[model samples]
Target: MERMKEDQDQIYYHSGADLESVKDSPFLEKLIKKGYEVLYLTQAIDENMITQLLDYEGTKFMSISKDNFKFGEKDQKEEKEKNKALKKMYKPLTKFLKKKLGDKVSKVRLSNRLSDTVCVLASDQYGYSARMEIIMRAQAFADPDSFGYMTPKSKIMELNAHHPITKEMLRLVESGEDDERAAELGHLVYDTALVASGYVMRDSDYKSYADRMYKWIGESVGVDPSAPIVEEYPEEEKADSEEEKSDGDANLKEASSSSADPASEDHSEDSSEDHDELLYRSRTRVEDEVFMATVSVF
Candidate 1:
């Protein structure tokens, strides 16, 4: 009741047949500046009145009644008039979300509204309004079970006519959406709406969309999707490998010293030791001579 009042944005100190019976609503003027298709949902916003507003903006009425939407009459008529090749040529993403989120939905269907990217609207405008529940539950004096019985109603997946994702999704789905990308996209749109409407998305366990998104990031960085984790070759093990390598280098040095050839390039194994001894004696003599020369000069 309070929700209906707030939603109506009513004028005070009067009795009227409907909420919009306000002789001159200030809100309506502002809304018109934005050219919003505000359905003048006064007290008379019933089935017949809503039906009359269907072509208000040629469909921006927002008073889509269940009677008008009944049993595929108008939908069938619209579908027949539309290009058979085009709709089939492009995929409707809303259709995917409804199928995935079955029980918590009224129905998921394509929208003709080119305005909003997405909006959470009534499945049956007269049956259960998401806004009504919000308004009723918000009241200081309101019943609990009245709103408790209601859940997030029909999610109206409105695609932005100019959004790249919407365009790509159409091309991709029409081409074939059997791959994970399509699934991820469908999941993203649904999740965006859930978050937008301040509702908790409850399908985390069923689908790891986060994990999939992370893997996509990993792939972008030239990394493998299931790459093995690198274990730090334990600190102790790393020290041992370094020690072994150093010991091997020491051994090679010792071998080279012993295997030197005196008669070959520089020295050979046959007389390398003798050559080293002679070179040592020469160096010693040179050092002694330099020392003596220094002393004489002093």
Candidate 2:
């Protein structure tokens, strides 16, 4: 919370920058640019405590994460107009994302606060911060069903107009509505932004995104995306005949009999065989998990 005079009614806050090494984020950068002195609430308790307190003296505390945060700068009007223009310019792509990513995001709009990043996720005025949701989900007693309702809904995605990635995406959106690649890329962008904002994603959705990423990687590597994987099987070793096995057993018996202290002999080879059995079991288990993941994605 910002230090205030006795008559002051407004307070500004900055959270999640406890460590001195924590550099300026898009949110903090925008605040700094506006010449506001923000009080950083680096500790987890700092935010929850402030939320409980609500106000100090006559001033109401405000969080940077909240959409209602506004710096009363004289040039704010011009900035608002610029942001509105950006939203209008990117309306097609925004609508495309909203439709394609239905329910995953509440809204898509032009970002007014970004400096360097291509896009970022912002919660509504009453919604939970990504950090707060993380804390809630981490609770041991949290019920999946009840927690779903308690969790924040509809994070607003803010896109930067200056970034090359956003620019290219806008171009793709303008190219045509029939562009399947654009739609795929749009989903990728949303997923990336969602994760980057510290929100959890459904396992199935994440797996699908990973599969799409692999396909993209294959294409980049000059491999055909639709091509079937070619597998090379190693040749099977020939099994020993019954007569050879008998001879080998006879030789082993003779050798054991020759040894005065057969029990004292090293059994490392037997132990190695046991280890190999365990290794094979472990490998099979891992392969089974991989298969399950692949199936879930599909």
Q: Of the candidates shown, which would achieve the greatest TM-score relative to the real structure? A: 2
lDDT per residue for candidate 1 within 76-174, as digits (tens), equals: 445445535444544465565466656555565444433344433223444433334444555787876666555444444444434577677666666
Q: Which residue pairs does candidate 1 place in steric collision?
A: 18-43, 260-268, 261-267, 261-268, 261-269, 262-267, 262-268
Model 1 TM-score?
0.41
Off by over 4 Å in 2: 1-14, 17-24, 145-147, 232-298
lDDT, candidate 2, 137-190, per-residue tens: 777897767756546556677888878988888898898855678778777777
lDDT, each prediction: 0.49, 0.72
TM-score of 2: 0.68
Question: For this target, which candidate reaches the highest lDDT against the unseen true structure?
Answer: 2
Given candidate 2, what's the lDDT at residue 272? 81
